[model samples]
Target chain A: MTRGRGFFPIIRSWSIAAVAALAVLAGPAAVPALAKDYSHIVIATEGAYPPYNMHAPDGKLIGFEIDLGNNLCARMHITCTWIAQDWDSMIPALNAGKFDAIMDGMSVTPQRLKVIDFSIPYTQSPTTFLVLKSSPLAKMPDTGKRVSLDDDAAMKAAIAAITPALKGKTVGVQVATIQYNLLHTYLRNVVTIRTYKTTEEHDLDLASDRIDAAIASTSYFVSTLNKPGGNQFVEVGPLFTGGLLGKGTGVGIRKSDPELVAMFNQAIEAAKKDGTIRALSLKWFKTDISPPN
Target chain B: MNTSNPFVLLGFGPNGWGASLVAGAAMTLAVSIAAYLVGLVFGGLAAWARIAGPRPARRLVGLYTTVFRGIPELLVIYLVYFGGSEALTSLGHLFGRSGFIGLDGFLAGTLAVGLIAGAYQTEALRGGFLAIPRGEIEAARAVGMGRLLMLRRVIAPRALRFALPGMGNVWQQVLKESALISVTGLSELMRAVNVASDSTRLPFDFGIAGFALYLVLTSFSGGVFRNAERSLARHERAR
Candidate 1:
């Protein structure tokens, strides 16, 4: 054992060096040739978001956006592969060319447009507050009513109506999201706002009464309510859309990929016309969220 | 069996995540092994430089170890994952390539963890070298052994024996640090478990599964290092 030990170290070190060198050479070596080839593309998604994009128990990605993405890709004549990505870094990764586009329920906001581009809106869902059924806040004002932030008077009135009930209450929303923006901009003075990393975390907090209420898209809440302990939660308050919420969920693409964005827009238009979007939305969300023509 | 049962859910059924979880564990091991090997190369070279190289070489290694060890592992990972691609893309532009050239997730993660692990490994290897008795080196020289011959016959063996335990500790560190690679979206064990839990809405079940798998890996690797240490020390015991 002792006789061979010294040689082993020398050989091991050499092999280690060799492996490191090979890894360095192989790691970023696959430079996607700068061609206008639209034959094959990779799409990224935050697979944790249900009814939009989510992983199945079998490790396959499936959901509303998955269906729509495949449909759009089919129409665009591109073979698209979907990869799960963390929500926070989705845009950066797209711009970095980690993937060609993002279809992870990403809303097209004016703030986001400054960085990346989006395809035409594929699905539009309203934002609302979720509360425990037993909580007094469950009976929030203007329940089931839609409030477009574009109508400043209606938006302010909706905020005013809910402020009195939410005063001194702690509300939860996912961080760095349109819902968080809405809360920070409008309800910052009224309620103590808490931010969470994911919608599921806030839903858990609401179920445990750590938060008086949680806010997220109505489509997301549909998945929440379908969960085992979700029966205890109820959606209240006016539905919010437009303005700060952006122009609904769309495929997030890099600004350099104008042709890809155009392709997606064309496919989406076809999908809407053919009722493919409506069918997928009904299958996943049980509602037609296809943007009105 | 009920699909809601934890065993069934983690089983190999059509709806179960057992296969994916196992695949993720394999990925975790692959990444850790690759990164550990990278650390070994960096650590060995740095140790050699710090001990015998010129003053400028030692200072450069010093700065590298300090900066890598000083930053948070997550930040290091982010820098490698995003920054690596950014650098590559710019480099491509320099070569008249217009589009992005991404650093593979597995590669970025391994380099990040390996670079961090290298800092700790450098100290361990350096200590191993320092702990070598001066007389042993002198004895090798008196025997008319050349530099490379002495290094292979005496220095390498003695230093490695001294460094075995520290190297073992660094292996453990590298294994745990591999979990952070999940952020790069390389489907490692943690990411698999997260996807499973989130998808099924059964965090408790999947969380326990992840906990068990990680425990098994750590304990099994711990045993391997212990055995390696024991084998390496056999001559001392015989004497």
Candidate 2:
């Protein structure tokens, strides 16, 4: 009889603990932390990459990716939460289960796809170089034209044009990025290569005279040049696309999260149809970088 | 939301990070041990320089300890991460080598944490050294004991006994400080939890789990060090 009486309280406490655990497992969607679910899911962004993502001086994340992510989330009935993660461990952190998905203008490259999955392309842009305006590469012909990597003649011409100026000079690129891979493959022996963890870091190093040139996305260069400190650098060399640059940037998700992928796909489609992607692209990049059809 | 799936994220399954977390904990221990040893060596040199060397040498050692101990730990980790590789490459360049000099994350993290730990350890060891009775050393000398013999028999044993508690504190400090190495991209326990949280989008879940793991590490180590102190003090009478 005493044992039976004691058992009730134990069972009651156990059930209470179990309920609390279940509530957390249900995620913010079941019981929205701040507002009604409205089928709205919160998306996370780094807010460090310019044009793709960046921070306003007032400490707000404002960039092309943030705009695109918000629009996509609105279409999918989800909210957005932009946060920063150190770029090197972003994949490891993604696999560890931090946020629902990453929409930091991460390119949909085959190499990156090995560890995680990506949504369909959202924005497409080619890689380019930004160097000191007085640098010889700035004198190269057709400075503003886009050139594909597959065009042998154009590729040779581009290589020939930049090689002499780049010879014995130091070039900076973000580590593990397509731009770094491109530099290493095409010009490793000819020039000194320095890889930084982020575009901003390389940008800082460039300003400090640590590197003669920096290679990144054209949109990124445009945004950087708009900033106060970036007035010294000018775009140089052919805009590199296809092969190694992979396709356009896309949303990244863990392989196990198929449901989340479906939800994001729906939202991305609605965003593209409504011209939200294009609008954000123009706002941040000053040009249309919406996924090329 | 099912309690039945409590083990889903923690279990050693393909989806779970249990294995990674365990490996990360092991890495943390490894880095801490390396850092503690490095601190021991650095502290010994520092104490020697301070107590036995010229006035200028002592001042320089004092400055090292002061600067390291005064600065915040996070800032120290950042300075080391960003600046360590550059410093190493410059050294390599002096040897006429070209190209980037790779300082693996683990080694760099260990060195940074160790260098910081050494500053605190130096003062502890010095206090221990100073506490040695002057009479005991004089007696050892009267008995025709050489400087080496006096240090081995009288100075070291007594100094170490007094220093045991202090050394234990330094060890604990080193263990805790290892967490800062995560920013260098070392996949230690904290970093593993970060990765898991980012991937799962369950910040609260992973953060709480990481907090629990750290508590366990500290508590377990606290017990071991307490036992060691007790054993070391067994021969001495209460003051």
Candidate 3:
């Protein structure tokens, strides 16, 4: 029964496409009638995804993505509009033609790449865990050291060491993110996972004791730790990258927008070479976050 | 686009969003109701001040209505969420407490919704007050009723009757404004829809579901308000 209904819409859309195709063959004006492309490129962000894109107290979109988007647009000589769209609706909205690009610090993982195209990464960083300062898990091991999950002995040791502290503990992660995927893959058996829409929400829940720990971008985790409210929270665990976490955050574009995608890629490359990307990263993240060459 | 798997989109199974969407709708109603009540309390005070209070009180009420109505609801939510916690923390510190004093999302969201609600409600109630005949108050006074008795016996009832329709409008405003609470990271309807959309990778399905849920809540609430208006207007001639 459901199959019947689904087939009807597909058939209907196909008929509409056929008609659109015929119209395009008739004239140049009909060509536009065949496909609707927006003039102003609308960029959508969560406006709560800190350092990448977040809302200012005065209700304006601010942060790294805002700056990067503006610079990229300027370099590409395109007129674009920025809007604060809810993070969850961003991809759907992009497909729905509500926006043209998504720059909400969204990672370009294989799962996401299946649904959309992402430009060359703008910023690359590792994912880390945030636990309360007083939590025993905070002192587990490997402070300021990078440990790849592929290193069998080190990974096994680290996992074993953190397992006791993680037992029965709730770890908060943003829903549908790489961090959540990582936690689900590596820590799901040992810890309970609670999903939130934005990192900010998880941060609030972590502070409120709704969750014992959170997994997020190291840059974002650092920002939270610096905030006056997150006094008790400290970054912990070895930073994880490459596998599930994706390469880095990028401008998520429609699969069809290759021209725009190329433009962004060029701007990103230029920005990295000119020190603009690292400068902005240092401004927002207080560290050089340019993607490794 | 594929309706073939309705269960896959909204199912209660491993892939279904049915349970999540339902829970989201329930939360939307809950937050809207809480915000509306807060607004009603604030509106009552502001309307009273506008009608019967001294000059300073009248001016203060005017300022509140103007400020809230003039600003966007999104800005108000931001200020309440980001600034509200800091304000509470300082207030807590004044009493010698050191830890963070979080205004829970529900309370912060309620305040944001209420502030916007109160702005519209002030006008609703003021219209209600004006609609009350001066002769009715005088008649209560002439019958040897004290100020409190006059208010309780005559003023309150008539004003409420007059305010019912306007209050209905305010209720709808509050219901829609509650959508903004999603920004505060509250797991209300919008936030829940967000989570479902992200998790499922079928945003169109979840978004449509969310839109339908909001419509259900709004239309259902309208029915309740219509009943309230009907009961209040029983003695009066139908328009």
Find the candidate with the highest TM-score and give its number: 1
Q: Which candidate do you rate higher for lDDT, 1 or 3?
A: 1
Q: Estimate each model's TM-score.
A: 0.93, 0.54, 0.55
DockQ of each: 0.42, 0.03, 0.02
Task: Write the residue-wise lDDT of candidate 3 on A1-293 in tens digits.
Answer: 00002100100011223234322321111101112233346687877777777644223568888998899888887767776666665665465333468998888989999988999998988888898887777785665567666566766776677788788999999888988888888788999999986787787677767788898889887678666555788888777777777888899997867877888899899999999999999999998878976
Best by lDDT: 1
Residues A1-293 of candidate 2 have per-residue lDDT tens digits of: 00001100100111222234322321111110111223433345665577677544223467777767776766666555555556765665455333447887688888899998888888888888887776665675556667777777887787777788788989999887888888988899888999886687677667667788899988778777876556688887777887778788889987866677777777777777888888888887888888755
Clashes of each: 0, 21, 1
Q: Note the Cα lDDT for every prediction shown.
A: 0.84, 0.70, 0.73
Candidate 1 CAPRI classification by DockQ: acceptable
Clashing pairs in 3: B11-B16
- Looking at candidate 2, what is the lDDT of residue B106? 58
The clash tally of candidate 1 reads 0
Worst window of 10 by summed lDDT in candidate 2 chain A = A1-10
Writing each residue's lDDT as its tens digit, candidate 1 over B1-239 gives 22678778999888889998998898888888888988898888998899999999999999989999999999999999999879877866786767776655777888899999889999999999999999999999999999999999899989999998999999999999999999878889999998887666677899999999999999999999999889879976886
